[model samples]
Target chain A: MKVDPRGQRFAAAITTVVLAAVLVSASPWLLALQAVVFAVGAGAGVRHSPYGLLYARFVRPRLAPPGELEDAAPPRFAQAVGLAFSLVGLAGYLFVGAWLGIAATAAALLAAFLNAAFGFCLGCEVYLGVRRLLPAGRAA
Target chain B: MAPEQVAGGAAAAAVLVLGTVLALVLRRRSGRFRAARSRGVVSAADEAAEGLRLTAEDIGAPLGERATLLQFSTAFCQPCRATRRVLAEAGALVPGVAHVEIDAESHLGLVRRLGILRTPTVLVLDARGAISTRASGQPRKADVIAALGRAVQ
Candidate 1:
């Protein structure tokens, strides 16, 4: 199903907050929580994520319906990118040190902030760039 | 705050600032096209109008008589849907202008060849098959009309 672009931005806002918390606290559990959010967004789908639910239930109801709906692949791909980063961050927090986690979460925070504030998708760009390079995935 | 915390905070601040600058630049320049040499299709008389020159075969679609609004979109791009509406309406309002939507995912080679970084990119091509200008993000109706005007004039 097509998704309301605003919903993705809303989800990104929530993620920005969570990622900020992870960076500030250096908490492994918090990074894990973010990882879970990413998993839900990527694996299950954006519509099924908690933030999606929140947007649908609260924010979307209050706002007028979106004029157009966009495909779900890019945002979902973006969610997968977030999942990868958060997992790396969780690993950093658990085994190595808080610094790596902070760094990783900081990266995620940058991307989320871009999406929420500016409406650009850095992760989506990265995915497209990577897709271009991969021989088999070049057509994707 | 701890020294490391201070450093971390500073880094975060820097990222925020950078992202903001990037956003503003992108938003400002989204619908503005630049001078590009098109090897696609253009009559000998219009070589000076080196905008969007594409052969019908190159774009995988027929060119409109007066103008064509070529849009590159991906399934998950939100702005692309909005862009479609603007282009569609603009095309309908103007005589001899057509709107064509191409899925970025399906046309991976085309996207790469064109250096398309984002979705909902609109390419305004004149009747001669030369692209007059192109917009990177959702283009305004006025911009599209203006692009069309530039093309035919």
Candidate 2:
């Protein structure tokens, strides 16, 4: 769908931050509802992200590289792994209570803000790190 | 559980669900609106003519001879629209303070020349045209005002 990486990242970050804020301020049931809403929103974003799509239609022939032109598709597995980490962080806060929860919440908040302000995905970095540790054939 | 606690829990749950749903719907709608395109390119020399190509001189003028608030925006930035409102209100509160907005899209060449990568960037310029502070996202009105005061002083 020709989604810009920057835009996708920004969306992801905003979603994560809002989710975290909801978790912090809302009741348990409310948090669950927010999680669902965030998941759907993220799913929609994934659908639109143009990570691998060709851009032949949008740009001039001279401006595009040879062969198929598609928008860059964000790495799905990588993004999923990032989302997973964010969930883990949130869950840790929810289950552990107070100090631990606040710590995890802070981490998630930092990750999200970093993605927004600097376009750096902490979750993606963690995913890549874990992926690197896996055996060759086991890596997704 | 106490009756009050039960009621509170239910209310909280309702608020959460409603807020999440509202946020989701808003996000979905906002996605349809794309950010604005960059303005025509400007040369290095042209950028030099203006201290910063992303900033507009007229808008940066002091607010009624008191304060100056400058907002850097792109044509299609939703947050920029919100930020503009906040600045306008702040301008109203303080006498002699002027709020200025610059469209990055309108001056794409200058933006590139100045190495701006993000839209809706705000820079509070002092009376002398030097940048006092810069914010990449929507800034709180109080923070902007405080920075402006600092810069003016």
Give the alpha carbon lDDT tens digit for every residue of B19-88 in model 1. Answer: 7888888788877765455446556566633323576776788999988899987665657767888898
TM-score of 2: 0.35
lDDT agreement with native, every candidate: 0.79, 0.48
Looking at candidate 1, what is the lDDT of residue A105?
A: 78
- Those runs of model 2 whose alpha carbons end farther than 4 Å from true positions after fitting are A1-140, B1-66
Q: Per-residue lDDT for A1-140 in model 2, tens only?
A: 33344444545555555645544453344434434544543465443433212222333333534432113323233345444544654565457543433343344445555555544444443432343344444211
Candidate 1 Cα deviation (angstroms), residue B58: 1.3
Model 1 B-chain TM: 0.83
Model 2's CAPRI class is incorrect
Q: Model 1, range A11-130, lDDT digits (tens) per residue?
A: 999998888776666667877987898999999999999899999999998998898677888789889999998988888878877677778878898889999987788877665556
Clashing pairs in 1: A71-B75, B52-B130, B52-B131, B53-B131
